[model samples]
Target: MNATTQDIEQLGINTVRVLSADAVQKANSGHPGTPMGIAPIGHVLWAHTMNYNPKNPEWPNRDRFILSAGHACMLQYSYLYLTGYDISLDDIKNFRQLHSKAAGHPEYGLVDGVDVTTGPLGQGFANGVGFAIAQKHLAARYNKAGFNLFDYKIYAICSDGDIMEGVTAEAASLAGHLRLGNMIYFYDDNHISIEGDTSLAFDEDVAKRFEAYGWHVQTVADGNDLKALTEAVKNAKEETERPSLIKVRTHIGFGSPNKVDKASAHGSPLGADEVKLVKKNFGFDPEQSFVVPDEVLNYYRGKGDEGVRLEQKWNELYQSYKEKYPELWTEYDLERTGKLPDGWKDKLPVFDPAEGKVATRKASGKVLNAIADSLPGLIGGSADLAPSTDTNLDKYTSFTKDDRSGRNFHFGIREHAMGAALNGIALTKGLIPYGATFLIFSEYMRPPIRLAAIMKVRPIFIYTHDSIGLGEDGTTHQPVEQLISLRSIPNLMVIRPADANETAQAWRVAIEHKDGPVAIVLTRQSIPVIDQSKFAKAIELEKGAYILSDSEKEPDIILIGTGSEVALLIDAQARLKEESIAARVISMPSWELFEKQDAAYKEKVFPKAMKKRLAVEAGSVLGWHKYVTDEGDTIGMTTFGESAPAEDLYKEFGFTTDNVVSRAKALINR
Candidate 1:
């Protein structure tokens, strides 16, 4: 017996809904309404619009899909299962259970088809835009005559809450500006939210608003009409100058007799009676729970076969391209594997201590340019402060979706999207992404940074203008608490280099430490490079901290500082020596790295015998407690910054060498 296309689609859609509802009901928890309401959309996209092989979810050219409204994870899980991925029915049954592959939300490495871990409302929406941006860039960079190697779409399903987020608006605006035609979004206009109809708070014309953002907007009056969804997506694919948003009107709980179209259906599980009634409405046995018809299972199982064939075809095509263009194939393969080309680090500049004072920010640019030569996969841009941040790689062209040959990106003022996009590129496997902005504005990039850390993706963040030394830009631009705040976040390595040489080492750590996210916090003002010949090599930065100055006997006082303030501490140590005060200076670039050091190394750096410890930083003293005991004094800011030159600001804020010396003497006497 043969089945018509309509029969196949209906069976697939109902299967997804039943599986999702059953999974939620079995767990006695979860948002089933969204999966049920959006099953047809998922069905049309996964089975029809998307070019993917569940057997090879990591196919570089496979279209990407993000369930932006990730609270309804059952939708993605059902698709992963039916499409012949590694996910099994038992995985669905164990939804939200500890250690289950089917987590409450989609996590990248945990689930087979999950592109990114996205449960934080609007993050998925923004991350989807980033994925689309990566696709656009890759396509432009590698595609050639008869070698459209990177033509793939990025699709996302967003709910009312996802659209209501501020990041969504920002990301959507950027998507439009970049004209990511391959990016498509389906908005589930189901009316009911967790608090009843979105009418209670959100009633704006979403399609009209998207139009204002330069997106090609469309509306399908009936979301269940798979034909209409297919047509709308077809039109969206043909649009080359804009991203597309399709407002899909859907029922909250389609076919559920008691729960359909109600707010109660949005979050909670329907009762047994309602579940039975819903099954009856779908022409199923009322008493049977989690019952998937043989025909439905057989139909979904066939997807595995279809996916294998698709990947086989792609492999053949890749083989043909390889034979015709061996060099391009080699480059593409190397990039796809995410391995840096040889000698990338050799290009990193080594600063000479003989060259007076140099700001770490300037050194950062030099380091980036050096690494950029070796790391072809490295792509980045700054948030309108590239000149000040010194993050631009010299002579490298800027990457526009229109022209993909450029390695650098220009993110304008969208630090939030820049961070999210960097994650997207990093998720692409073969790309190393970094972004830049002032240290103070890291707050804007914090969410994606946290996600990057959680996902364990190495996306470097070059944050300059680190602390009160930012000077005349004043308190608003100065990052007083930002250092400690970044330090507080788990899995995030915050590195504040003391000088130009340490800046190079910090870059090394950021690139080499692939387990998690790393932020290279640099300074706006110049700092004296410690003479490695006089003391230990800058390579000691890997230990997190090393003594730059020491005495024959146990020091009377110890001075600890990071970034630019380390220079001030060195000067203070000289003054103390003049006064016959024995003081040691320690340059601690990263507290997180230091804490990871062996106990013996830590003790050696800051000896337990030296009870008189003092930390002199130009910012808030929150992070100094561990280094400086409660009995010791911390000479640092307790408040916001003022408008003044960096030198005067240091003097006025009592961060000068004289103040450090005075504080150290006072702490020693106490």
Candidate 2:
């Protein structure tokens, strides 16, 4: 590089540093240290290394960048502004303000060029792994020998907190095992954490740990050495069999006078005096904030133009490939646009009530295999519980290191990593991903599930073993409160289906609902299918709650239930009619979906005249009170389940026709 070019690059890097500090200082609450220290890293990746078009941020083959340490979002915002993305200088000035694009942490849809939300530490790292997986799968499936249609790299800047997180460890292990060569991560090894130096708790050699995980690891002694960082990245790209990690040692507060290498700099801003001193140290105007020299702006915009040209070249190559392989190109286009093939729903199986009883989990497996041939974008796996959760697509081979074209995945006992990886795949545009585990273990993956809800992405979650019905596993495996907990999260639709038909409808809801995440809760034990001929159609499951059977006139009591308990409610209703009493049976499958219905529709399902109501379920009854009135009663488990046969457990827990009839009769008398 020439002397003038080198001077301009340095000026641009310093501009990012000062602008980040100014934003945090003005906000009065933000993390500014890592951004100040890692500005050169961003400058190298965005301006010199990565191929990304700011003019079209959604370019399919462009390299993806994620800031796993999202507290330093000012660094990303400043780079996006400088590189001519949609972010403006005014947006930078409004950091952390209400309704501003510049949130305290990087949010995916709120800001341009941010690949995923990354506030809770290690989720971004796992998300990058998911991105690499999608890239490899697409490349293997679509890229012919002459047509390299999908060859994109995934890059992320992680920190000490990110590395310390166990979720990153799990995701790193999986990435190394899969031999994802397209992933490159930089560890900002600044040694200082919020508490103090990392020695207080974290002292392990992370590079060695990654080396044990089958990754190519390199270390740069100084973070500011741009030449070394660039060379390391090049070497990583050359190693086409393993994921790479470049550990760059850096100072926490690089140019700040008083707060350098101190814990105070990790989150809190360097005060006004120190900010001015830092600018003076960098030879910038001490009085100026958010200043961008004309030369630096022009230099970065030139790099942006280069990105546009690169994308245009790819587009030209794609056009040629389209001509050579017309049908394949059309399929690829559909995948990218998220448009399901016509008649895809025709493949979904509907169960008949006359057929023998079937577990909801087993019914789910049938639905998955039935639709797998039609929906090419559907891909996922269980956390080493495919057989138990009944989530495997038997028609496809398992996704392994040697074969990336398979539709099935073996996430291998990593629930947290699997959740975050699903988020990554959902963000990758072309694919719809799902992950499965026991409903009780959802607690382990709640962070990513909540993130998916917050980002409004569509990642289906198959959580089988819905309640205390999983026999012999006892209290530890039985989920008493999982349903209520999952239902409590806003924008997350939790559907506990009644039988085989409702299970099929639940899968339909999961696939068709694109607004946010959906959790289909299923049962391990067999439950009889409701006869659609005698009752309402199973398609009514979309309305969330519906009256299955009612008396000729206004019912004396209402018996509401979900999942397996609905079968018991049906039996109880029949018995009440034999005794000259009238009762109504309501199938309340999903509270979130039902709440979305209009007030008149809700009133139609639960009439105001029927004040006497009874709710029956094998789980906690925390939220059932909303449907059941003050005079109503709930027959739910008040204690943990015991290790016994499923039938005995149901009887012991009062999940039976007798219990439902008694509860309904008592409510009617009251």
Candidate 3:
């Protein structure tokens, strides 16, 4: 607050602005305005407010920072470089170039200090909500009365575009309802968008809107006022019953004389002459690009050193807590590393076909409940469709504002927010989260699903009502193309389990597969479980596509199916035998998993010599052609289904034993 200290702080803030502008100008393809405008908030939070050690970015209890407006990534890059993080000045110079750490957006794992991969507008905002939920849940489950081991705040800098996104609205509402006191978001109220000023479309009183959502809203008239920004954050932290949103008014381009308040500055570089003028306005050398005065560097590094000391204190506290609660500490450590306890899979229930047929969704519910007691890290719920999705953990209480220790979540009809929040929880490293909804609604939350795949995070998505079998609800509820569409996402494992045992194995795969997101598609109607005693073991599902049953010799024809359609294929196999035509039944549960198999294994499953093949699936037939040769045919729903009983719909849609037999015989004759 003194004159010399204030001068140094101002110098550091300007240094961030100049460096960010230089990176964008050098790249010639980046957003430079918001960084220039929001540099003061960045400097205040990273240098003085947030407790994070750059050297140990993954410290479990460290405060999380997300640049929700990730287009202006140079702002984050400059701060990372200045604060002694692994990001170098040369990396900033190479912004937006191939192989550079400073991508056009802030990618989580690509940079040492970036917490989440954020780009498409409001995703980072929702991700921050996930972080807050993780912190609250961990604090509730692990922290002792005197030991505040899991207490940490989540902060994000959002922009006009971020606020406009519907996902942010959903996440903000949930955060407020949960009373996530650890969340604090700063809105960069520059009033500019890609098209023009927000008045062209957006003109709501954002503060009042958040107040309606149960947030403690505050406004800082000037974005550049560090003291005011600091005080606003302090007050936000003190308010424990609600999340906080601070609207900081700012110019689109803070120092550029001509483009200061223009929409043009929102994305493009300021050009050479304008950049020099802007530097002159900030009392910096016009000739310098990516320059950091030694004093500025030292000042920020000092802050980083302070973070190290804070972490050391936490480490000492954690050691004491470990001694006091050894068993809890062991489980906590395992959760952090994403390691399931030994023999946890032994808890999964195995079903017998003679036990009577069961819907895959019902079987999934039983499997979830059976393993919930052993896998403490497994936690999630449906989008207000828990009973329908059969995703509720019945043994546990609901996760609410009053009790964060409960594992069951009531996501409440917000599929979009549920997807993004799951990503946030997965990113927190101590929990394995899942979200459930009907297969059709996956369309509503595809962005977060794609983001989860991109980030290579583990978040299980349980989508029931898997096909036309979810009948009587008409075409809107039935998912004809959802299976193929989900398969299209790279790194996403889309597993449509054939029956109860297969559903159990899918859950096992989801829990063990940590490289990316997994979707377990289940059925609403009961289908006869394959007799495991006579056919291949259900565990063969991990191979993706396995021969469920085969003839006495090399089959003259092959029958392939997934989900409930597999049962029809098996019945068709029996009927084909009456004509002395040999057939092999292949349960192709997951295309992504199948593609991972070696070429020799793939050839074994669908051999070239046995070109006569028929594929049966009650969904789009687009991707099934690869398994069936050019001489073969596919029996699937080419058109949307009509309202009827599930059995009537299947018979009407040609997803029956007779249809499968006819298709197989036709393929063989061709």
Candidate 4:
């Protein structure tokens, strides 16, 4: 790079720093240090290192970048604005405002170039690992000797907090084990957090830890040395056998005079006067905020033209590739659009409902095998629970760093790693990835699940042992609050299907959903299939909640349940009818879906005018407050359950027909 080029690059990086500080200062409430410290690193990575098309942010082969330390969202927003993405300077001015593209944190679909949504610490780190793995798999499946179909890298900028988080350790360990050489990360060693120096809580040698995990580690002493930063990145790219971590030692708020390295500079913007002083110190107009020199604007805007040319070059190569390998080109085109083969779903085995009762988990395996036959892009495995969760497809091979065409992944027992890796697979376009484990273990996978929600990636979570009915394994194995906790996450669809048909429907919905993640909560115990011929159509589950069985007329009472408990409500309805009581049984598979139903439809199912209702579920009653009205009761556990046989445990825990009948009767009397 020439002297002028370096100046131009500095202008771009400085513009980001000033714009971020200005935006945060104007908002009067935001983090500033991270943006300032990470500006140079972000600049070098986006402008020189990463391969992305600003015009086509969704380019399937583009390199993925994640700001794992998302509190420094200004770093990303600034880069988005300058790099000719769709974001405007005015949008940056409106940072943190409602509906602004620049939200408090980087959200996936909300921003054009952001690869993943990140706010929770360490999530982005793991997501970066996921993106790297996806590239490896895609390359192995498509690239021939002359056809480098997929060759993109995953770059992430993390902070001390991100490295300190347990989830980060979990993700890094897996990334190392997978030998993903395409993954590169920069640690912003600012040594500061909300509580002053991170040394107070984190003094461990991160490089040593990563090295122990089998990663290539490099350290740059100064953050401002572009030459060193570039060299380090080059070295990282050269290492093709292991992932690389470049620890960049940076001064927090490097150019700010009064706040550099201070805890106050980390979260709060420097006051207006102090900002002016800092601008003057940096040889800029003291009074001006967010001022971009014309030369700087011209230099950065020119990147858009360069990007178009780069894309054209790639297109020319792609054309040649198509001519040389038509079959591979066709396969690539199908994968890019995320389309399943015409006969993919044909093999989805449908077990006879009359066939002896089977655990939903076992049924899930049959469904997966059928889907796998038709959908070559469908790939995933469990967190060392595939055999138990019944998630592995028979005859499918395992996916290794060397073998990416396999349909199954051995995620060991690392739930957190499995979740992050699934996100990576989903982020890699043309793949439909899933992760599985017992529902109770969702807590371990929650961070990645939240990232999936934030990124709006369609990562299917197959969670069996969904309730207290899991039994014998004890309360520790039960998921009392998982449903509500999962439902609380935005963009995550929590589907607890009642039977075989509903399970099929759940899979269909998950498969068809292009945005957001979906969890299919299943049961360890067999749930009787609701006879669609006698009851309401199973298709009604699409509405989220529907009257599975209705009385001859408008019912005097309603029994609402989900998953396995729907059978209990059906049995309770029979006993109520014998006593001349009119009761309707509703199977509520997904509260999020039910809420999507029109008010009229919702009222028709759980009439606003009716007060007699009973909510029966073998989980926490936290989220039932809205459906149950005056005198309505919820029969669910409030505490952990005991270890015992599932049937006896259900009876002992008041998840019995008698309990349901009594609860309904009490509601009617009220």
State residue 533's C-alpha deviation in candidate 4, in Å: 3.7
Model 2 residue 147 lDDT score: 91
lDDT value, residue 278 of candidate 4: 70
Full-model lDDT, candidate 4: 0.85
lDDT of 1: 0.84
Candidate 4 C-alpha lDDT tens digits along 1-670: 7899888888778777788788999888788888988888988887788888889988776778889999999999887777789898898889899888989999888889988888889888988877887788778777889768688888999999899888788888888888989989999999999999988898989899999988999999999999899999999999988999999999888789889999998888788987787778667898777787877777766775577677777788888989988977887788778775676555656657677677778778878887876677788899888888898878888888767777788887888878987887788778899999999999999888987887788899999998878888887788888888999999899998888778887887788877799999999988776677777455576789988899997788888998889889999999999999999988899998888889899888988877788898888898898898765889998888889888988988899999898878877876
For model 2, the superposed segments whose C-alpha errors exceed 4 Å read 536-538
Greater lDDT among 1 and 2 belongs to 2
So what's the TM-score on candidate 2?
Answer: 0.99
Per-residue lDDT tens digits for candidate 1, residues 507-621, read 8778778778889999888878877676554467887888887865678988998888888888888899898998888889888899999989989988887878998777788
List, residue by residue over 492-541, the lDDT tens digit for candidate 3: 99999999999999999889998899999999998887787886444578
RMSD of each: 2.0, 1.1, 1.0, 2.2
Give residue 370's error in model 2 in angstroms. Answer: 0.4
